[model samples]
Target: MIHQVQRSTQVGRTTHSPKRRVTPIYAPGRRHPVGQVVGDAFIKHIAFSKHTLRSPRAIAFDVSTLDDAERAGAVVAEIHDTESRNVWTAPIALIRSKGFPVRRGFGNQWALTLEHWSRNGLQSEAEAREEQQAAKQAAASVVQLGLFGGGL
Candidate 1:
């Protein structure tokens, strides 16, 4: 004869909830828009230009240190045009004495100014030399023009 015993079993069930999504939050502060930043830069440039023009003596000293003649002349011209109605003749003379070829053209002027900065330890010597060479080449390429005659 075989005897059978009955066993009781209990099962537990758990319910799970889905995770929620979150949005990014930003702090409140003055946001500098791109246009505003550009406008500020423009205003600063204008102010600096005005200040440079007001101080012709300083401008002369600054230009005198530059090695390029054209650049120096350009600086003088810029000062005269932007800062003062009267010409800054003294600065022009100072620039001419520095072996810079007095001439027209934006590049020539920039080269002269950069040369000055280079000579004064403000710029690397190599850079200054390069600018000088470029300016020289530019000047050499220009056809000579007399007071009355056109380009020769």
Candidate 2:
């Protein structure tokens, strides 16, 4: 039970009260429609460019967080652009940040933002993974020195 303290009209007096729980009024599932068009009217007024839409071919927002995918912090979204006869893949974040409303099915706004990034030329997932791996390897190869000023 949730409670709130209310100040009484009489000075130096208060009462403990329970607040009523409010339920959602909308259909539980209509929360976040994936790729649901934001429309030209809305996009045009925004700060970002609308005319320079992300390459339809390169916008693959992969949503996965299993094993290596989680370790790498992103997953490969292999989007096949049939009209262009080209396949493009981009990395989308696994753990999302705050602010974007959590969707009903898809979970949160991270994937949606990733989709926007993919449309605006985010790097390929494969390349990002490769770079991350290389960085790890380089860090591991570094020699650690002892506090005594000699290799222990």
Candidate 3:
């Protein structure tokens, strides 16, 4: 009697219910997502390109982090492109720095400004040049200190 009453009380379904779409990254102070960037810092945003909107960038899926898909400071990202599709185990930093902005998505909350991207590019280039200069100076010192190599 209870089983029949329970079934009868349920007035039947009107439409199909869909599951809520969960995003991988979220604003700070919120519940942590499944994919954690490194330790506690979540992946704030992702950008890929040579610092321009025209450049090609990898598409990042809101994927959950797998146990074997991570290294010290990198993660295995699935690369999907027009030419070819391959798996790239790149540093997390690179992935975020090069990611491009999407016209539409979860919203600006998931995207970084183009200015930030430009600045990052410039900073990395500057660091590279500085390292080269340091290396050259070191080589010159090595040569100067060689046997009978001190000033003529």
Counted clashes in each candidate structure: 5, 1, 5
Residue-wise C-alpha lDDT for candidate 1, range 63-99, written one tens digit per residue: 2223322221222322232333432222334345543
In candidate 2, what residue range of length 10 has the lowest lDDT sum?
A: 36-45
Q: TM-scores across all candidates?
A: 0.18, 0.24, 0.26
Model 1 poorest 10 in a row by lDDT: 34-43
Residue 147, model 1: lDDT of 41
Please list the residue runs of candidate 1 whose C-alpha ends up more than 4 Å from where it truly belongs after superposition.
Answer: 1-49, 53-57, 60-65, 70-78, 91-152
Q: Order of all candidates by TM-score, from best down to worst?
A: 3, 2, 1
Candidate lDDT (C-alpha), each:
0.30, 0.31, 0.36
User: What is the C-alpha local distance difference test score of candidate 1?
Assistant: 0.30
- Pitting candidate 1 against candidate 2, the one with the higher TM-score is 2
Model 3 lDDT tens row, 1-152: 00001111222573544432222433333464423333322333333342123323234433223221233222433222223322223333544565444554433312222322223224334346778999999888877878566743
Q: Pairing residues by index, what is the TM-score of model 3?
A: 0.26
RMSD of each: 29.0, 18.5, 16.2
